[model samples]
Target chain A: MSITPEERLNVAMTINGRRYRAGVEARKTLADFIREDAQLPGTKLGCEHGVCGSCTVLLDDLPARSCLTLAVQAEGRQIRTVESLADGQELNTLQRAFREQHGLQCGFCTAGFLMTATALLEENPAPTREDIVETVSGSLCRCTGYETIVAAIEQAAADGAEGNDDAKDGAQ
Target chain B: MKPPKFSYVAPTTLDDALKHLASDPDAKVLSGGQSLMPLLAMRLAAPSILVDLQHVPNLSDIEDRGDHIRIGARVTHREIERSALLADRLPILSAAASHIAHPQIRSRGTFGGSTAHADPSGEWPTILLALSATMQAVGPHGNRTIEADDFFVGPFTSTLRDDEILTHVSIPTTRTAWSFQEAAVKKGDYGLALIAATGTPRGGVLVDPRVTVGAAVGSVTRLVAVERILTDEPLTDELAEEAAVAAAESVKPISDIHGSSDYRRKLVASLVRRAVVELKNGA
Candidate 1:
C-alpha cells in the first residue's frame, strides 16, 4: 500500500552558528537536508548503508553519520560540517596538515575524516598513535593506507598546542 | 536514495505512539533512524506511517537505580560510552557500545533500537544475552517485561507484538564479573564473530553467552551445551577453551561474503576462548 504525501514538516536547526529552517519531506535524511536544503554539499554520501563513514558530521560537538539521521531529528540541534572549519581564506590546522601530509586522494572521504578528526582532537588534545587509530577507526580511506592522515592529525595537534601560526597556513 | 513518501507523526506520549502503531500494522517507529533509514532507502521496508519518537520525554534518560539501572531505549550509544555508572555496573554494555559502528553511529544509535532490531550480529543482543538483561516494552495495552533469551526470535526480528514500543532496558547491578571480545574484518562493520561472557554473584556464573557470527552466519544460535558446561563450572582458561570449542559444536554457521562458515566457526571458538580466558584472569 502506498502512502499519500503528507505536507512537509518545518525543521529549524543551527549549523555552524547559522540557523536554517526548511519544509522537508518526512523521509529526508540529515545528509540530504544539509546538502540539498541548506546548500552545504561538502558532506559526501557513501554506501548510504551507514557502513561507510563518508557521511560523517558533527551533531552537538560529537561526530555522527548524517546519512542515517533524520532531518526532523536534528531540529533545534547544533550541526557542524567541514565547511564550518575554515575562517574566510584561512584554513583550519587539520585541513593544512591534511594538505602538507597528503592525507587525501580523490577527496571523497576527506570531509568525513576531517569531521571525525576534529571531534577526536577536541576530546583528546595529545592523543597517542593508538588513540589516533581508534579515533579514526570508523572512517575508511581506500587510498594512502591512512598513514599520512594519522601524521596530519598528529602534526595538527602539535601545531595547535604550540600555537604555531605558520602551521595555520598548512605549509608545514 | 530518497525514501518512499509516508505520513509522519511525532507522538509525544507513549499512548499516542501505540495508537499510531496500532492504527497501521506497517507503521515503523523511528528511533535515531540508524537502522530504519537504510531499510527505507533500499526499498526493503516500506511503511505507510512513520512514528518519530525523538520528542518523547523520559525515553532518553538513563536512571542509575540502586540495584539495577533503567536505561531508556533512546539512550544513545554515545551516552552509554560516557556513562560512569554504566562503566561501573554494566561495563559490558558500555564496552559493546564503544565497538558499535564507530563514534558517528554511536552518537545517534539507541540501546533500545539495537535490542529491538534484534540483529544477530549487532553488539546489543550479544551483550544483553550475556547479561540476561530485561527489556520492558510499552504498548497500547500496557507494559510487559521480556527476558533477553525470549526477546530475539530471528535475524532483524523481535518477539515484540505489533503496536508495542520498547521503552527501557533494565540490567542487574549485583553481578560485576564481565568479559567481552569481538573480531571484525574492517572498521565499523558488523563483527565477524563476537562473544560476551558475564560472571554472576554467589560464584554461580550466568554463562548465558551469545555467539553471533555476522555476515558469515545467516542466523545466530545459543550454545546450550556450552552453557551447561559453564553453568556449574568455574571460569578458567582451560575450561573456557573447552567451552569455546563445545560452543562451536552446537553452532551451524553458514559461509557468506564476509567469511566461510568453517572459518567463522573457528573464529567463534578462538574468540570465545579469548573472552573466557580474560574472565578467568579477572579482566
Candidate 2:
C-alpha cells in the first residue's frame, strides 16, 4: 500500500513480546512510536541522527538505530527494547552487571547501552575485552566514561548472560 | 529531529519498485536507511515518496559466480563482516567492513547503500575502486553495469540515476596482497584519510599495484604516479618514502572542521607509507 506524504499509515510491531498497533504519520520514527504510542520509554533518544547509539533496539534480533528507522518501516517486525532485558521485576544479568559495575551515572545513556550489550552477549557469549570495547565504541556516555561500561559488558559475558533462560524467555 | 513528510511504499518486486520510481521524479529509493535516514531527519532531503526496498526479493544474496563474488544490494555490512564466503574469497572486504561505524550501525547499513550514497569517506567505495569491482544497476530503461572508477562522481554523488536501483556488486576473485589503512579521531567516525592498496607479489617484487585514497580528496582517487613508482619494484624503506611523497603530492585534499588540507595530506602520506610497509611484509 502506498502512503501519501501527509497521510497517516496503520503500522503494527511487536515490541518486547507485546504487539502494538498505531496509526502514525510516515515521518514518525520508530523511537518516538515506541515511547509515545507504545508507552515504552525505556528506549532513549540521544542523538536523533545515527551518531549516538541511544535509540538502538533489536530489529528482528539485530541491533538497529530506532531513531533512524521509521515506524512504518517496522510494520509486523519484532522489536526488543531495553525493557526486554528484565524478567518481570528482576533485572537480567547484563543489567545487574551494569548496576554492580557502576556503569551509569546520569543514567540517560544506560538504556541504549543495556540494549546494545544485550544483543552483543547473545551473539558472542564469550567476547574478549577488546571485542566488548570495539562493539560498544559507537555508543557515547558522558557520565561514567567508558571503562565501567566495557567492564559491565565483559562481566555479563563472563556470567553467561547469553544462557540466561529468564532473559531469553522474557524477550520471546 | 523527525523526518520530513513523505509517502512510503514497500514493493515486493523489483519491477514494481522501478515502476514507482519511474512515476515520480521526487521519489527516493530507501535501501538500508543508514545514510538516507539522517538526511531525512535533518530535513536536508524531503522527497515526495520513499520506495522502500525491504520487501524486495533477491536483493540480499551473496553468491559465488565461479570467478567472482556477486553481493546483492540489500546485503548489510554486518552480513559481509560475518560471511564465510567473503572471508575465504575476499578477506580485504571483510576487514574493511569491520572498520565502518560500529556494530549497531553496521547491522543495518547495506553495502549497496553505502556505494550508492557515494560518500568520499565511505570504505566500500574506496575498496571497490581498489579491487576494480563492477556495480550492477537496474533502471527504468534496463540493466547495466558500471565500473567502480566511473561510479563515484564526488562526495555523496554517483553516476546512478534517480530512477535506477543498484542491484549487485561483483568483485573478481584474484590472489593479491592487500592492506587497508585509515586515520580517524575515533573508531567508527569518518576517517581523516583512507587508503586501500593491492598488488600481485611476484617473487620479492610487487607488480600491478593499485593505490586508492579516499576522504582526503573530493572523491576517491587512484594515485597512478605512486602506482607507477611501485610497480615491478622491490618494496624498501626508500621506495615507500617515495610512494608516500608521491601520494601526498598528487591529490588536493579538502579542508573541513575535522582536519586541514595539509593535515589530511600528511595523513595520506603516513597511511600510504604504512600500507606499503605492510604489503612489503606480505599482507
Candidate 3:
C-alpha cells in the first residue's frame, strides 16, 4: 500500500501513443518521469512549483501540470506531450499556425501553450478570443508578447485545427 | 525543485486510507495535488507519507438530490465548471470555477481538495460559505458533517482532523440571485480581493443577503455588517454604496506582496458594490 522514498515502484503509462514503464521513486514528479525516464524533454519545467505552465501535458485528454503530478499518480493514464503535436517531421495545424503567427520567440513555454490549446480546441472546436485568452492565461509566456500567441490559437481555430481527428483519438 | 523524501500510499478504500492516516501522525492526504504539490516542491511541508485519494471509489460523483446537490470530494474544478446540473442549479460555482487558476490547474484540482486546503485566497471556501454548504468528512471512527462557516479556521487551515478525509460537500439548491467578483493581476492569478454574494430578491427588497469576502484576510469572512445593511432593504445604488463602505471598514486584511491592505480594502469595497449592483440588476 505504501512505497517508501528509498524504494522504486514500477509505474507504467502511455505517452504519445507508446507505453513507457519505469521504476520511479514515490517523490519523482511526472515532469521528471517524462523528461528523464521516458526521454521526452518537450515538456519543459520552468517553475517547478506549478506557477509556470511550461510543464503542462495532456493527462487523460485534459491539460494538467506535469510538474505538480507525481509519476505514480499518472499510472495507467494516457499522456500527450508537445512531441505528439507533429506528424513525423511535419508540423500539425496548431504548430503551423503558431509558426505563421510568431507565437513563440524563446519557445520555452510553447509546449505548455500547445498542449493547453490542443485540449481547448478539441473540447470546443471553435473557441472565441476570450475563451482562448481565458484558457491560456494560466500559462505564462515572456516572449512574443501574448497577442501573437492568442492570434496563433485564433488562426489555428480558423485553419480548422479541429479537423485533425487523429488527435481526438488519444495520441497518434 | 524536487519534492522531499516521502512514502506514497494510494488506497482504493476509504477505510484503508483512514487506517493509514490514523497510523501515521505525519501523513498528509493527497487530494488533487494542485496545492499540496506546490507546498511539497517548495519544501514548506515535509510529510512522511502521502495518502493519495485518487484510487478511492465513490469520491468523484456529483449527485443531484433534487433539493440539494451532493458533490464528492474528488470532483475536479473542470467537472464543476462543465457540469450541466451545476450550471443550472449553482451557476455561481461554475462562474467562480473559471476564476480558479487556469485550465490546467482546474482540470486536476478537486473541489473538496480546494475546500480542505482552505486557502484564504481560495474561491471554493468563499463560495461555500456564501452558499451555507455542509462538508462531509470520514475518519477512522465515523462520518461527520461540518458547516462551511466552522470548517475553515485560518489560512490553509481547516477543522478536518489528520485522520479524517473530506468525503463530499452538500449544497442546498436555491433561487437566490448570486454574483462573484474578484480582482487579480492576471486572469488566472490568485485574487487580491474576492467577493461572493447571494440574495433573494422578493418584490423590491433583497432578502437573506450573504456577502462573503475572501483573499483579503486570514480567512473567508462573511461581512455581517454589510449583510445586515442589505437584508430586507430595497436594492438601490445608495444601499449598495453603504454596504460597500461597511465591507471596507469591517475587515483588517493582511498586507501581502500581491496587494497592500489599503488597496485590498478598496478592492473589497469596489467588489462589494459591483456584486450588490449586479444582484440588484438581477445578474
Candidate 4:
C-alpha cells in the first residue's frame, strides 16, 4: 500500500466561481479538498459516513455529499459550496429567510440545509410543502423542530417566484 | 474520518477496467462511491488500488428495451427516482430510490453498486428479487448474468467475483401493479423491515404474485408460500392478511440496535400486509 505515480495526482475544479488546482494524495475527499486545499471551510462534516448530509455541496447544481466524493473525481465538475450563497455583504433569499424565521440555533447544520434547499428550489420553482419537507429531510438539524426551516425554505421559494431570484442569484 | 491513501485509476473503457481488475489483486471498483467511500472513510475496508469507474463510457444510461428496462451499473439512485419511464414500468425503483438516505446520497449512489454490495437491508436487493431482475457482470473471464434471487449471498456481499464488475441490471418490465413499503425510525435511517410485492390481476384472479422481504435477515428472501397462496386466487383483504402472517413466520430475524428480532418480524408482516393493500389499491 505504498504510493506510486498513479497514487499522487493533480486535479482542478471551478469551486464557487473560481478555479483551483492541487496535486495531492488521491484519497482526499471533496469535503477536505474544499476545506483544506482550496481553503473554503463552509462545508461541515457531521458524520463522514454519508449518514449525515452535513458535507452537502452543489455538484453541477445537484446536491451531493462531498465527504463521499473523492477530490480527484471532481477534476472537471462545477462545485458550489455554502460560501457561494452570498456574494458579499448581502445574503441569498434562503439565508435571509433562515435568519428572519429563526431557522437555525446551533448553526452547524444550516449550511447543508441551505445548499440542499438551493438545488431543490432551482429544480422545481414552486415545490409543494411536502417537497420542502422531503428536501430538508436530507440534512439533519437537531436544534430547530424543522417547522421553522420548512417555513424558511417556503419563504425563499415564494421570494424566488417574484422575479427577485435572478438579481439575487449572486446576492450582492 | 479521512480515507487512507491509495492508488487511483480512472479507466474510461471496460477493457481497461477489466485489465486493472485482473492485474491488481487489491483493486476495488469505485462506482458512485456512496457506499464505498463511507467504508473507506471509516477505515473499515481498505483497498490499495482504487479503480474508479466514473469515467467508464455508457455505464450510466438507462435503456428501455421492448420488454425490459436495462439500467446501467453507474446509474445513480437519483436518476432512477427521476425517470418517468421507471415510474410507469417499475414504480418500485423510484419508490425505493426516494428512501435511500436522502437526496445527497441518492444523487451519487449507483444502482449496480448497491445491488453488488448486497446489503440485506437495502431497497434494491428486495425489489430486484421481487422483480426477478438480471444482474449483468463482466470480468476478466467473460460476461455473465446472475438472477437476483441467486445474486445476493449475505449481508454486504454478493456472488460477484473479485475481478468481476457489475455492468448493468435488466429488469423485465411488469404490467402488474407493485407496491414497496418500509418502516424506519428516521427519514434517512435504514428501515427496520421492508416489503416489496407485485401482483397482476388476470380475470379477477391474481397471477404470479411475488413478495420479497428485507432488513430482517442476511439477504433478501422471497415469500414463496405466500406467492403460491395468492396465485390463481381472487385477492381479498383477508387473504392478504393470511399471506402477511405467513411472511411473518417465514423470516428468521436478528436483533440489532435498530429493532429487536421480534420487532423486525412484526414490522415485516405488517409491511407485507400494507404493501399488498397498496398493490391492490394500485390495481
Candidate 3, after superposition: displacement of residue B34 in Å?
Answer: 0.3
Q: How badly does each model clash, as a count of residue pairs?
A: 0, 0, 0, 0
Per-candidate Cα RMSD to the true structure, in Å, reads: 4.0, 1.5, 1.5, 2.5
Stretches of model 4 off by over 4 angstroms after superposition? A1-7, A161-172
**TM-score, per-candidate, Cα-based:** 0.92, 0.97, 0.97, 0.95
TM-score of model 1's chain A, to 2 decimals? Answer: 0.89
lDDT of 3 by residue, B1-283 (tens): 8999999999989999998899889999998899999999999999999999999999999999988899999999999999998999889999999899988999999999999999999999999999889999998879999998899888888999989999999998774689999899988889999999997678877778788999999899899999999888888899889999999999888897788999999999999999989988983
**Model 4 RMSD vs true structure:** 2.5
The C-alpha lDDT values of all candidates are 0.79, 0.89, 0.91, 0.84
Which digits, one per residue and each the tens of the lDDT, describe model 1 over residues A86-167?
7778787888999999999899999999989988887888889888888788888899799999999999898773222322
Writing each residue's lDDT as its tens digit, candidate 4 over B149-193 gives 789878888899999999999998764778889888977788788
Better of 1 and 3 by TM-score: 3
Better of 1 and 3 by lDDT: 3
In candidate 2, which residue ranges exceed 4 Å CA deviation? A163-167, A170-172
* TM-score of model 4 vs. true structure: 0.95
Clashing pairs in 3: none
Give stretches of model 1 more than 4 Å off: A1-6, A161-172, B201-220
Candidate with top DockQ is 3
Q: How well is candidate 4 docked (DockQ)?
A: 0.56
